[model samples]
Target: MSAALGLLAVIVLTAATGYFVAQEFAYVAADRAALEQAAARGDASARRAAKVIGRLSFMLSGAQLGITMTTLVVGFIAKPALAGLIQPLLDAAGIPEGATGAIALAAGFVLATLIQMLLGELFPKNLALARAESLARALASSTLVYLTVAGPLIRLFDRAATRLLRTVGVEPVEELHSGATLEELGDIIGKSQSSGHLPADLSGLLDRALSFGDLTADEVMVPRPQVSTLPSTAPAADLVALIRETGHSAYPVYDGEVDDVIGVAGVREVADDALDPATPVGRIARPALLVPGSQPLYGVIERMRESGEEFACVVDEYGGLAGILTFEDVAEELVGEIADETDAREDAPTTGPDGSWLVDAGMRIDEVVRLTGLDLPEGDAYDTLGGLVMAELRRLPCPGDRLTVALDGASGHGEPDGASGHAELEVVSVARRVAEKIRIRTAAAPAPADRPEISDPPCAAPRPEEASWTR
Candidate 1:
């Protein structure tokens, strides 16, 4: 009976070890998937599943270690009894008595390893992967109990491991439970949406939320041309009148052109100060925080949070004013378009006939690229369509000038017709001679070819820049 109990103990230890291993690995996979889904705009279910799996994973790790240690101790303690039980079998098989103990020990160890590796580790892990949500939910409570019981021991082990790792010139693995990165979370959300585990709108909202990290101040800022400002020389009464007419909370104060902006004035301050009517706008203005157009929106948000500033002036590399970015701009990127009580303008500056829109002349190129699905090149030098056009052309183009824009294939090759797709840029229009503004018109070109092929131009001269701004 003692021998039988020893054998039973070994079996239980092996099984527990396997179970913990499988649980740990499976939870890792599930957590990774969940994080990706969250980033991709996945539904709450995926995120919840991920969270449960992550918590359970740590518990599983502790359980595995405990079970392994316990198994070693128990097996060592039971070795003599287990060996005695196997002696009879070895004798019956005509094995030497001297070798019986060694044979029995080897056989028992092999059996335990096999059972742990297969039944405990592999099978449970496969099951968990197949139905992660269900498995995670079911295992959560038990795992928590294990974690609570083993917390102190786990911490001690972790600290030791960390020190050992540092001694070996390796960084300690950060505790795995922190959470998933934005991109990884996005992928999981995308998968959930594809699997019909989440609703479309909610998934889309989540994706947009993740995108807030990638957005920049330039992409969301109100362009310089679109900003309403008070001249520094303007009287306080005139500044107040302009603010009332525009219904804006704040206005940039400029000495000359908008590019020469000195600071920002808040309507509330104007009301509170009740400054003399002849007071210079600069006298009422507050110092402005200036940010580069290339600054990421996330960084801008952090800056706003740390500085307690509400407005930032975006500028180009030339130190010229580019636009104005507000806290609301960053907020809108995370939560979608936010129209406030004071935003009375019905028509945006750059609407198209089919509802496809042009970014305002002053709008940041990054924002246009995000909203319009345009593939703009990356660089710090330019942040608007006008700037991009000017860079590419090298010279200011006349109304009838034509230029070719190339679209690289998927493999980044100039394939006009091949498996990848055609590469070509057709001239749509050019700058209006008098106004110095380019009026681009859209025209249907042949579908991109898989291999290189050039189509003949129908027009003798490039189409003239259209006079109307609407299209």
Candidate 2:
């Protein structure tokens, strides 16, 4: 009867050990955000779980206490009883008396350790991790009861631990949790994309947002020369016409020069019934928000929000208007281009005669490589094809400027015979003293001898198309 009682006590204590193990893991691994959301929607279980999680240190202490006590009780009750049960079996096997007792004790200890580790620790720990949220909610009530029963002991332990931590230069009040840093978040997004758990576009947007804080306003702004402006002294009628022609909602009104921009005038505000059409734009224009070119994009956005202005003029170190950034520009950096009715998009790269291509000056180097399948050098020296050309030549390219260099591989189909090639810059149009449109010509690749020859299409004559480009 005494041995039966000891076996029952061992079973109960082992079960308690497993329960505490599950409780500890479930609470720690559960998503706090998910718990909070459930609590907000009036889930009693989630509310209780969150309450326990709030004092995570104390809750962990309670779990440790329970696990330790239960393990100790099981060890004391089961070891002697199992050894006694095994001793008779060893003796029946004809083992000598002295060796039989030692062998029985060793065998029982090994068996007990294996059972305890498997059932009371590893199995419960894995289950909690796999179904952290559900297990956390299911165990919340029992965990609370355990805490109530051991409240005083847990509090005493917590106080001692906190005091010891404080002595080691640690803040006891700060929550102990692992947080994802920007780099780690980026890696997670990358992995999610690769695993098909996230869409590529969504992954890209998340990555952009993660790095948004590191960007500056100037990187996304329209350069000074590209910003359209109206004279502060211009008549309201002219302002209306400019607005219609530009299709821009706002324009900076300058005192005398672009650098002297004094205010911003919205076309809608000017067209209001309270305003006079004959009035000078400067009289009705709103004061312009001036921001440094070096200001972080996030801070600029906050400033825009607080000031209730969607546009700002970025000033350089010398107090000159460096560029202009609108709310849409900053937002685009985070979420990508927000197209509207005014957007004129080209669906494909223009093919030129003699197996060449006509690309815009603003075409990015990466886009060029992607479309043309040409491996061009990428560096900080230039971002666009036009910029690359200028940097190579050390001068602004004219309509006839030409340069030849070896490509990583031969240009496909329309390029000249050799792996090497030349790019002739045919300036189609100019804007803001730069080539806005350029026609690139390369030597045609020779057709295979076995394949029938295909005729090269005639070059499309360049039409005069030059205007301010907005992205």
Candidate 3:
């Protein structure tokens, strides 16, 4: 009976080893599953299961150590008892009596090692990993009970281990430092959305809102050329007429060119003002808010929110007016396009056939670049078509000066039109230059036959000055 009891103890110890080994690694999968389930339905069972797995992990760790120690102690203390039981088996195999004890001891060690490694460690670990969620739930209460019993011992060992680890200059693991990346979080959110755990519209909105962070100010800002304004010295009646005609709430009050602008005037301020046809436009204008062309859209948004100002004049580095950005322009960034009743349909920039674009005179140069794959330099100097033309001309350009310009189709992956495979624009007519505002006519061909292929020409080289601006 003693021998039988000793055999049973070995079997129990082997099983304990396997269970502990499995419980340690299985908890991670169980915890993840529980979190996913919780996100969907707030599953109490899953939560309990996750708690159980955690406790089981702790208990299993202790049990693994305890079982090995207990096996060693028992092998030493009960050797004679175990050897006597093995003696009969050895006799049946025709082994000598003297060799029995040695053989029995060797066999005992081998058996313990095998049971601990195979059953205790590998087998249970695999099971837990494979069916982590279900197994964790089933064993949670039992695992918790075991942990409760071994809590003091576990804490003592844990404290000792922690101290030893610190002595060896090893810090405890910081799970947060190993947390998910943005892509991983995005994936999680996407998966949640796909699984119907979140509302589709809300998820889509969040995704779009997050995506808006990627856009630069240049991509979203109102280009300088599209800005409409009134002269600072214009008659109050004329200013009111301009306001009435344009239907814009605010207008920049410039003295000569837009670059020499003084201030801005809101229609709302004029709405209540008494009819004073002779009042100078500059006198009624508010302080102008100016920003560099290169300012970030997000920073601009923040500044606008804090400043309480509705209008900002975009300027180049040379202190010339490039364009203007308004509160309405920034609003379009967050919520797509905004069209009103007063907006001219024919004057709007429209997509043309064969990968070309027909931009309106009032369209922002920045918007043109975004829509038609045009590459323009960024600085405080030029922010619009008019500003760009003025900067390139150096001197004021006249109507007759025909200049050859290259459109950067390579950057935007735009296909060339009929004349040539290269994407380039030829200035046909210098339409008008009212102060800083300059309008030029462009030829809608792929590229001139004389123009070199984009591939043959070094892309790194600066764009050639196709035509000089003439007076």
Candidate 4:
């Protein structure tokens, strides 16, 4: 070929190689849901992009075929042309004619390889990855055309690959999983937050939504000990006083044992001025919604919605009342604490000068990790820091109850916080038969002599009225 024609051919071949590389990466990285949304908005290029991603295996095969063919053609055109162009320069430099050809060939090979790798491979691949959706939409039409022209070769390659995969006990998929797994979604949310691509509040809400379904009745409920109950024989008028104190809309009415709840009564049902005050609450109570403690939170929610009940009594496997699950608990799992005018918000965890934190027992383990950077192991049996303390103690904790232990992890709390090594978890306050406050620090448990004076409630923090299970 003439020198000009050969150089032009090499440039065109290199362009083709870049095209295939870009297409391969763009198809993989493009978000299918975003493309679909654009297509729904009448974007023709997005529609083509979606089609390209849907047949990922076949399209990728075509990309491989195009890349291989272009690279081969570039080598054939450029190497000889490069040799021809360099040999004369060698002649002009007083090199022996016999040595010129081989020297030119080796130099041509190196130059050709560098040209292909940098321009044809690396640049396009990175550009495609950085703007995957944009490139996919811009190039999908031409990619579809190329795939049609190379259908037979691509299909043959795909089938052979599929058969080879099956022989090794693997199944070839046409496309990658379109939806992200919960764990992957969590990682995405975290990275987005760290990169400032997502708002912090939205990141937290999305994270909670992804994890909410993993909670069961047991994980999400108010424990039975905190339940405020009325004897079924008590006057209906007592609900008025209870509501005034606790501000709950509903209560579970039990015949005798809380485990034997007859029904649930609402304060709204007993506000009639002329209604007899002595009316038995059980008599006025409506049918109770019952759910097993082990039941998935989703199942509990479905039962409540289906039965039109605001509260469901969570029962342990042995038929004891585990606690009450409320719609507020359900909503708060996603939107966070739903405090009203009557509700007192729990205090934010307080960190001490010695790197200790006076943490509320009700805080989730995940939050504790974020706040203190503690690598506490999560357990299926419990979901809070208080629960971890209970597990370590293996029993109910009292004030000054000390559990000394070595915990492994960095404790800088990602700030100018104290070092992490030995951790002492001491029950600083107990309320309603559960640990209410814990003092966590990287030091030995205080000897009773060394124990600092502690108020029963720790910080004079007002009790959250919602702790009463007017569930």
Best by TM-score: 4
lDDT of 2 by residue, 61-149 (tens): 89999999888877777777677778888899999998987887788787678767988889999999999999999999989998999
Estimate the Cα RMSD of every predicted model relative to the unseen true structure: 10.0, 9.3, 10.6, 5.1
lDDT of 4 by residue, 315-411 (tens): 9999988899999989988887677877865554456666677777877776666666665557776788788877776666566667655555542
Candidate number of the best lDDT: 4
The runs of at least 3 residues in candidate 4 whose Cα sits more than 4 Å from the true structure, single-residue gaps closed, are 1-5, 344-346, 404-416, 419-422, 432-434, 442-471
Locate the minimum summed-lDDT window of 10 residues in model 3.
Answer: 462-471
Query: What do the candidate models score in CA lDDT, each in turn?
Result: 0.62, 0.75, 0.60, 0.80
lDDT of 3 by residue, 1-471 (tens): 477777677677666656655555556556564454674587766676655543444555565566666556545534554665777899899998889889987776666566656776678878988987777666666667777787888778777777888999997542223257656766776778768897866665555465566555555555565677778887777778887888888888898877798998868557756758778888888888877767877777777678888788777679888777877777765554577887644344444444444333234454445445455343466545645544554544443223345544432313323423223332223333422222233345533333223245322322222222211
lDDT score of model 1?
Answer: 0.62
TM-score of 1: 0.54
TM-score of each: 0.54, 0.69, 0.51, 0.87
User: Model 3 off-target regions past 4 Å?
Assistant: 1-171, 177-181, 189-204, 214-219, 244-246, 255-257, 260-262, 290-299, 314-322, 342-471
In model 2, which range of ten residues has the least summed lDDT?
Answer: 445-454
lDDT winner between 2 and 3, please give it.
2
Error of 2 at 9 (Å): 3.2
Instruction: Please tell me which model should have the higher lDDT, number 2 or number 4.
Output: 4
